[model samples]
Target: MMSILGLLELNFSFQLVSFPAVILKRLTFHPDDCFEVRTPNLASLGQEEPWTPNTLSLRLDLSDPSDPNVSISLYFDPGTRPLGLLPGSKILLHNVEHKISKRKNVYCRFINTSVLTVISFPPSLQKRITTDETSFTRLYLRDIRGSVQGMQQAVCSITRISRLTLRWNCIWCGKLFTKGRCAARQEGFCSSDCGRFGASASVVVDDGTAESLALVEAQQVAVMLGLTAAEWKVLKDEVWMRGELEYSYNQQFHDPVADPLWNVVAALCCKASSFRRFNLSFCLKKQLHHQDVSEKTFQLGEMRYATQLLSSPVLFVKNITPSDWKALVSHWQHLHEAEQSTH
Candidate 1:
């Protein structure tokens, strides 16, 4: 099946030329199979100077509901964004270039000959689309650990946070460089030094099922800690000055080790959000309503019910606190204990 996850696994040679217009014009696709827009247009290269030629570069985060674990950043050029494109909107892209960056991030670029169709659903269906896509993409850490393909979302608690390190990558070839030179120069590519500062770190997260290590990039680190890049730099400096930066991170908001039970939605390449609880009692009740079900059958039914609840509109429990997370964890533990006792 054609999916964002599938695209990530496939390798394509780098090409600057666009596909022929004749081929693009004849292509057709179903709206349901098309990738849904997760985030709106983002200026990938920032603002262009007056003297510089107009590039009109922007990116959109798009994912297919069939494979919600993966989302691709699509860059647009040579034209303005399509009208009526918004989050939850579906888009069918044709003749886009797929390239792997220096960070091994897979993304698509819309060239001059690319064709894009913005598919907007009805007002009633928009919420359903968003809920279904979000729920499908969100999985437990255990479930996502073995997946070798695309980015998977999980609501996990920070078990451990590592120290941040400063890194630089070439803008032209997107290659990492430490010495003041582009490695791509040896391969006859651009020798010009176009370095950009980036912060990198890893964090261990647990979602009660399993623990997994997740890498936090520059932008995500700032968002996950509720701080801007500049603020994070200042805090890092302070921590470095204290001579404790090698072992621990400064607790400006909440200590990751002490307050490890956070409700933030974490993914490989995404920002964090405020804590929120999800109600699964209705799902349990619904599953238990079926009488005379075998233990195995009941367990299967419970899983189905949980999935249904996640896809439902009323699943999100907003503005939840750390204490609420503790209570929720205890409640789950009790439920598991009761189930074991019954067995």
Candidate 2:
């Protein structure tokens, strides 16, 4: 947390890429498996890294949702967003990334944490959404995993949290990297704004009946593990550079034997003791991965986050504090202005 708090005082500039795209669409995409979108079209995106291999596209609704040319196509990757979106719904898009294909086609891409938000709630039924994770009726992992079920959602605690990404972060800034750059320089980065390193983390969620492997990003790990992004960065830096003990944000400590973090998660609606509980809404999906296939045969990883996070918190860490994300955004805007000045 000190790393982030220290960042705020630095007055460093960040470059923001896009504003929120609010559009009304019929909610169309490829595969039409769940019949979510009424109208669908063939897509030619998501054929590379940082993009879903089988990405699909949706049209941006304009001119009362009847005119065709008023809508532009937006591409999305599967399992990285929430499901249960109905047809003919108007929605808002945030944290969306922009890309251009080799054919010069514009692609508005959404990866993990990209909310395919459903905003069709009626005024009468429009209550404030709860921040709590949803609880599932099926209490065991075996029933949910081994069932011949259509779409299933459950609430489960995190049995084992992974720290592979946190360990492999940048030595100085402690930021993790994707392609060649760290997240700080993801869009527009100055030499002084950030550094880069490579890492990815996943968690094993066990509901006693079975264990499912979840593909996780760095931010989610900090939240569930109960440390601010800045603290983790500093803790990682001190451990790697200065050879110090782990730092905990909530508890304010620098101890070697103790892993400083909170062990509880909830907003009181469906609270459980020990680890945090989350509403896991997902269906059985037979996804095709290139490496998973052995000798030209298909492979399955059992039941996993082919399910969505059901618009809830997973671990005790709810949201990254404003200082964490907000500081980054503001930093980027300054960088954008600087780049414009040079041009």
Candidate 3:
């Protein structure tokens, strides 16, 4: 009898009030959950309105006839994505009405649906991305944490603190190197020679016409300055002849042998912004003048004497056919000792 009475009471309560069933599919958002609603009766509630033009609004319908306030929560997945649902968007809604009339009976009803906008990250495939450093770094971190924990353990045996030094390995040539000036200074490219690119014949120019000859000579000078042979030959015969009249017969009209090409070579090798300073300094030094000074006064000139240039160890190093850089080192060593003895 008591169970029957309880069932009847539940039925009566359900008939007066009902909750809408909610289903979340392919869940993306998780933070935006709580929702609130208030109505005098169910007949006054309305359907939901769209939140943004890009987003669809969610709606919840109530089954109760009583005008009661409601508060609810919802959930979805949260992962980072470029577009679609972000961290903070909103929800929209209005009211609805239902009516029933007949010859023998009359009734009125209120109904409504609430609108909700999604706010959270969506799952993506980028989570699987890995790099070598990151992977090794994670392993290192794990081992370090374990080691620290072991050191802190009360029952663990204490070992003498031996200072193990740091070390690194080169990525390119696969060589082990100790922690020192070479490893700390360079980015694991064991030596400058290892990173140096081999010299190749870069550009070929026409050899027939007088103008072609001039262009070739210009290109040869530029090659001495470290411009690629192909690049120096880019200004062809016709262009050279067009500007040829500006040069004079007495001018010698060769690329400046006045300065060691090392300055030009290093200037071009460095960054673009610093190029202007080099250009201005080269221009002010009268690099194009080609005037000859006596060999006796060569060492006394403003560092541009042709013999001084010809004697430069850089020229001796680059122009020779020797396979070893040690030959150049040997030549400089003799020259340095000679200079010291004279002094």
Candidate 4:
């Protein structure tokens, strides 16, 4: 297996070789470059037009297994792009072209004759890879407010949901529009006429120690609510009707109307035994570790730890069992109480 570093250092072109790497990110291709040519209406009249095969240009950020720190951008011009290509996917590149661009950036390109293979790791190996890449620790929302960063795991409750906005984006040009025609079509750049609807809502979450606002993206919201975009649109009237009925019930007993339409929806979604506890992973901008602070205590003990407020952090929410939630909560409470006593 060729290493990405060694591949870049090659002075001459080589062939019939393979390199194993993990994908870090998928870059977007230009609308014009990936768009397919539409068959003209005059073709029905027996006017033969030259056929142009649609081609794909995909760019991926890859890291070599030999040296995870070393990463490089690779461009693919394959006849057909592989499906299920995502970040953290392992792949093997065969007979790729190594070239330096005008900006002096070393990158690899996969030509028409090149081959790409998606490889899967064994269950044991996959677990090991995840453990090696991630450092897990239990922390409260208050402790995470400043002292920690990077990927954080926490359990929080939704206190408020607001600013729900729904919109659509052109699949080709990725232009966000409320309604009407896509900008790409107006400019004659795209003819696919494909668009996807997405919705976002601002939510305030509480974990006892502190409350923070998080902007839940379309995917997270959909997963948490167990409702697709289409379902959300279809059930809008029913949801409002249910909300009004609940409000009337609360009024009859003189109870507080704390749960609104979205709030009730969120609460009902979480009522499922599986969704009782959610393991949320948040990617923070700044990176810090407790061991680093301990090691450099004398050098940086007096430094104030500033809270890095989360601004649209990517969240991965997973359901955890009640026993697991209890264990984590107990550990967090003990630590939080100890810290509070000292202060």
Q: Name the lDDT value of residue 223 in candidate 4.
A: 51
What Cα-based lDDT does every candidate model obtain? Answer: 0.40, 0.36, 0.22, 0.49
Per-residue alpha-carbon lDDT of candidate 1 for residues 252-324, written as tens digits (9 for 90 to 100) = 4345574322212122122323211221110111111212222211122223211121111111111111223
Tens-place lDDT per residue, model 2, 209-325, is: 234555445465445555667865764554343222221222332343443321221111112221344444444443322233222222223412232221211222222211121
| All candidates: TM-score | 0.27, 0.26, 0.14, 0.33
Model 3: per-residue Cα lDDT over 1-343, one tens digit each: 1111222232232211222211111122123543323211111112311111112222232111122232222322221111111211121211112222354221112222211222221222111223321211111110111123211100000011111111233334534333222342366445522221112111111100000001112222343333455654442222232221122122332354743232333333332321110000000111112232224222222332222211100000112111121332233334445556787
Question: Candidate 4: misplaced stretches above 4 Å?
Answer: 1-136, 176-190, 228-277, 285-343
Question: Judged by TM-score, which candidate is best?
Answer: 4
- Order of quality (TM-score): 4, 1, 2, 3
Q: Using lDDT as the measure, which candidate wins?
A: 4
C-alpha RMSD of candidate 3? 36.2
Cα misplacement distance, residue 324 of candidate 3 (Å): 8.1
> For residue 106, what is the lDDT in candidate 1?
77
Candidates in descending lDDT order = 4, 1, 2, 3
